[model samples]
Target: MATASLSAFTRGIGRYALVAALAAVFATFAALAPGFLSGANLVSVLVNNFALLAIVAVAMTFAVSAGGIDLSVGTAIDFASFAFVSLVLAGQPIPLAALGGLAGGALVGLFNAVLIAGIGISPFLATLGTLFVGRSVQQLLTNGGNPVYLPPAGVPEAFRFLGHGSVAGLPVPLLVAALVIAGAWLVLSRTRFGRVVLATGIQASVVRYSGIRLSRVTAATYVLVSAIAAIVGLILTSTVTVYIPSSGNAFLLNAIGATFIGTTFDPHGRPNVPGTVLGVLLLGIVANGLLLSGLNFYWQQVGTGLLIFSVLAIGFANRKAAARA
Candidate 1:
């Protein structure tokens, strides 16, 4: 058992590419500016992008690992925030309000599951439809295309504490993100479901023939992904003074960028959660770094896109070479 576990762990490590990319980026940034690594600047990037990138990237890892995609993730995050905040402002209890918020996102995932797993609809089409559905509902709830301001009452101290509070000298967001990474690693490496899910990713037909229940797995994966995304929304709502109905729309591209980051980090055929965390932080640093250095947000976008493309190209080339061997 020990030998087998060690082998699998090593294999998992081998599949990742994000760590190398991270090292390269760090070197480049240090060469570009000594102030880039300033304590305040690094901490700022972590606090800003840690929650968004960690949740969405991890969720997307599951989706891509299963050969499915959840394009509605951005909408899911926005709608969740909109729902939760609206409920709180309406005098609902905090826990119930959070649940209500999560429902908006989870229901979308269930819809995707039904269409893709039950009715045999394409994953792309199914999620695309929910993307609009969730976004439209958010708009309708906010009265036809306006971002709503959320009230501060009835939001539990714990929820607010999670975003602003610190633990053992670490910010709550960073602490939570670390826990998430460890949890994902345990689930992906130490559980039967993880093995099955990844196996299904490699070949669903093989798993089915091996007596795995495809439908149940498919539905469950979507729900889990949706829930993970929902957590991200809750974090955003907690941190921001006001919740925006469409705040997550900007993250759509970022999420895809994160997916490529995940793929890059694991170019050897493994997905690297820690590397993903690094990828998200690096992306954050680029924006925050440039802005601090007097660059505008518009140029930040172009630079971010180029950096992501570079990561993807290098990873793809490495993967192709490995395949040929």
Candidate 2:
């Protein structure tokens, strides 16, 4: 009885390990780093660091919950950024450019859908191929990978608003992130289609036997994932006023890490919206705190990596203990 009780205690601790680490990190940074808890800095962390990644990580959660990984999310981001900047530079209206951006991302998703759902290719290989092809296409379009910059005089106010403007006293990007997170949570946790998607992920054969069109669901999922990722591209381009080739790939690894780390939040190890958002917050805080603490880029990465490992390890150890008990 004592052993069983001890195991239960250990498992409980492991389940909340990520949350504990996040609080500990935040408090530590607040104590050690000057101005770390300042309102402006907190806002900066949310707006600049957390918001974009949160969107991408949530998008990633959909793919993960659907029993696949989208290595091409960055590809979607780059395509959207390219389209948005290209249209703006060509004297198009901001609305039109935004549509073009979304269309570009949708195209990438459509391609992945065709490959995975239509051709029966594995999601991993299909997206990996898409990523490679995307890189090559960007290079070719940019004449060996030069950036497309929007002229300062031609920059539109509405476009700038997306990245820098505020609505209801909140940054626009953060507002958008909140909306995405909320919408995703609702779809996944409350909707019939969401339940079907999760069922497909867990047991594709069972879902298929239930008369659901697995291919259609899968195609729609990949498209949705890419469309969500494109939001990040729009915000990123607006922030920088330029579309740098392959720049969106920078978020790919971190987004993946965040999504997986989020799974630890679920007893069954499922991907979830709240968990992913928290994961993104944890990462965002760590990055900002490390920078404020005078850590260089390399060291910041190391710290982030170590933090992820520690959290995942704790979760894994607890899960094993629970199984044994």
Please report, in order, the local distance difference test score of every candidate based on alpha carbons.
Answer: 0.72, 0.90
Top-scoring candidate (lDDT): 2
Candidate 2 matches the true fold with a TM-score of 0.95
Q: What tens digits encode model 1's per-residue C-alpha lDDT throughout 61-167?
A: 67766777788788778867877777777878777887898896787678788888898777778888888887787778778878666556645676576568788
Mark the regions of model 1 whose C-alpha exceeds 4 Å error after superposition. Answer: 1-17, 152-159, 267-272
Q: List model 2 lDDT by residue over 256-298, tens digit each.
A: 9999888776665678887788889999999999999997879
Model 2 misplacement above 4 A: 1-12
Please give the range of 10 consecutive residues that has the lowest summed lDDT in model 2. Answer: 1-10
**Clash count (model 2, backbone only):** 0
| Clash count for each candidate, listed in order shown | 9, 0
